[model samples]
Target: MLLPLSMLIVAPVWADEHPGQAQLVQEVAKDTGKDPAALNALLDGAKKQQSILDAISRPAEAKPWSEYRPIFITPARIDEGIRFYRDHRALLEKIGAQYGVAPEYIVAILGVETFYGRNTGNYKVLDALVTLGLYYPPRATFFRGELKTLLELPDNMLAGPLDTLTGSYAGAQGWGQFMPDSIRDYGVDEDGDGRIDLQNSLPDIFASVANYFAKHGWVKGGPVAARAQPDAAAKPLTVKDSAPQWPVEQLEAWGYGPLQHLDPGALSSMQTFQGASGSEYWFTFQNFYVITRYNRSPMYAMAVHQLAQAIAEGVNSPESATQ
Candidate 1:
């Protein structure tokens, strides 16, 4: 998610000329009671990176499932995930049991977000937040809110100095790509070190990912998704919404039947994606929706689900015994 800040479209804009600097500083200072002068200094030092603005406009989530699946789910990534699991099996299992989330899911999130912490990001968190929050109009409000929360974060909660911290172009920090709000809300200090170091601490990273899923209502042992086998006379369907409001029987009546036998009364939804083979249909369940809470894109949720399944199978496979 982090690209080098290259090609400055124009001279860097300072805080004096930023559109919403005064109001943001006032609000943050009032809310956190931090020195207004210190906050001003921080913003004054933040350069509005055009690269950040450009990156936000073209998110990978915009890609189709066929194109998106290969990026995160791959043989190399799966093998690495198996190794990561083996390296952290005891901690992953312990957290998974405590949080009621599967260990594979926790690993899958890290695998997708940062390739298991290999690439958290390089953009300065301050500049990224400031550029999007003040300069980008489409999501200014949301980014500005994130900016404020970052300033409000207590010293004990952060792993390093604020000015030096780096994250995604969207200002998400740590292995799980947590934004400021998520850091404040779901971040865990699993090591009891009094700091939520998602970048360096393995326990914090794994537990935080598991905690996010658990808090979002991940159903333990519930199915995430399944391939659908539409009858020749199957009623044509499109992905209208991701919510699992339709009963399994209802989708069956609509001509989209799950390949695996599921409880006919269970609530589910159908989604169609342009796959490599052809149009592919899937039956998504409640656990599938829980993954979407981490990333709104259905493709993202599907990729995570598929990767988790792949990694889980690989870990237990006899072939992995040699790994």
Candidate 2:
């Protein structure tokens, strides 16, 4: 399931003292030019459910590399990754060249997000988005904006209310787990079939992933991360929310330096991951930050990177050797 983005922030909710969810449904209807009464009716049963609101307002989990690394790089996942690449080789290559991102990275993201479109989710998107937008107080504004976007989508884009119900928890739908707004903004009809279908269209999904990376400042042919060794006298640095805030020069001044094999001119940020036994250091480049845009977790970014590498290596290896 696509995890709720609200997990990044949490706030309290007061139902009785507020304008009530009825007003929210009306607002969405008004904004989208749909009938207010119809929208209100659609939300009648949905508004009463508090469990969805409760789920959206919870804090996100922050796991160390020690635990996160193993979850994504499993043998089963690697095998699937190889199959994904082989199946979509042509489309992957075309999209990769167009966007200047590696095919493996795109494959890894799809593998991680929806298991190559095998498990998009079972939640109703309208129910999830409306529940979060109206009842979840912390990130209500963000989700409400998403709700407005969902309502603005052309009637044809939706698979009717019934088919649209099945998606991720946070209302991210289709292969790449794009939120409704993202689908509108970044999705592409790569197959030239006159429709953007991330659910069943491999070309659209591939293009959307590439488009997302390009928009997020993905540097073509750039290294994602490089091994780094800090001097014995250097103090460990802390990262809040897996963001790359520190510059490469600052990291070098602090006694941590990138590996000799990496280019000196690369723009890099210091990253320290807590392993089970000790700390692991690396210099993350722009491509690394691009992965974080999908999910703002260093562990997630690294897992995707490693999985992509594993997939590429596995694909090139002898078939008998891999088996």
Candidate 3:
């Protein structure tokens, strides 16, 4: 029997280009309650995006702190943090109270993560997540989890079409570079408009950030970090746990004490930073570890802390907010 041309259906060339991705579509669809065909179609549309893999392999945080600090702790970023705090002062304060995180940490998270929403990246979040989810093996487990989170988002949770969604190469989205999973778990609709818009909602962004920190156990009144004058013969240390492995009194017995006054028994993680000046020994408190929970890097936490401090100084001085 001869069928009309309209009866013919063509298979998409992009479909099943990577067999594992097809399997992923099935798995994510099953887990997230999305239609398999719709999920497969979405996965098929995501380009390989080798650039994402490349970018992930060489994250700036991999650099020594000496080099990494300057990238984020610029004078301009401090000024921006001050200005950002000033602009969103009320919301930051309100959210800070609600979440028990300080306003400066929220501002610093935004300033460090996306320059206060000025550069949230141009790569499609869908592409970055899907590419890493399907192809990148080393971090595939983490990316796959984030992908599922994105898949499970209610239609109203998204800012726009998935294809148009864009963020960092690593698939971190919004003004705060939250991974997809964090978006769902910590995102807030501060405006009470009934939708969480991480892309355009500054109130939501600040709240989400504060919520993340609070959930991570950010100590409201605890010291974050302090400069330590370690004995010349003292060996460096690498952090292994969130709690301080070394107590302050013990470190002092070893000739390392806070240059600033603090409780002698305060538990802390010791880390060495390669500064432009020289190697500096430091003791990081519970709040510092809380910041590290955001990125799992000592360098990142220090940079954010240092930047926040600078911004705080600028805010108090009002003269250094010149930029």
lDDT of 1 by residue, 145-202 (tens): 9999999999867769999999999999989999988889999999998899988999
Candidate 1: worst 10 consecutive residues by lDDT? 2-11
Higher-ranked by TM-score: 2 or 3: 3
Mind giving the per-residue lDDT tens digits that candidate 3 earns over 1-323? 87444223222226546666666667777777789888777766776666677778898988988899989999889878988887777888888899888788889988999999999987878878877877799988888788877877877677777778899988888899988778888888887888888899888888889888988888887899998898777655656754677788878877786899978888887788788898888888989998988998889999899988887777767474554
True-structure lDDT of candidate 3? 0.81
For all candidates in order, the CA lDDT equals 0.88, 0.76, 0.81
Candidate 3 stretches greater than 4 Å from native: 1-13, 233-238, 318-323
**Which of the predicted structures, 1 or 3, would earn the higher TM-score when compared with the native?**
1
Cα lDDT tens digits, model 2, 1-323, are 66456433433333333465556656766667787666555555343245566655552335668877877778988899998798778889989999988999999999888888898876677767766777677888988888768866766454345224557768888888989888888888888877778888898889999999999988888878777889998877766644456667777888987776665555677778888779888888888988998888887888888899899998778982455
Candidate 2 achieves a global lDDT of 0.76
Instruction: Rank all candidate structures by their lDDT, best first, as comma-separated numbers.
Output: 1, 3, 2
List runs of model 2 lying over 4 Å from the truth: 1-31, 45-60, 159-163, 235-250, 318-323
Clashing pairs in 1: none
lDDT for residue 182 in candidate 3, whole number 0-100: 84
Regarding TM-score, does 1 or 2 come out ahead? 1
In model 1, state the lDDT of residue 226.
Answer: 88
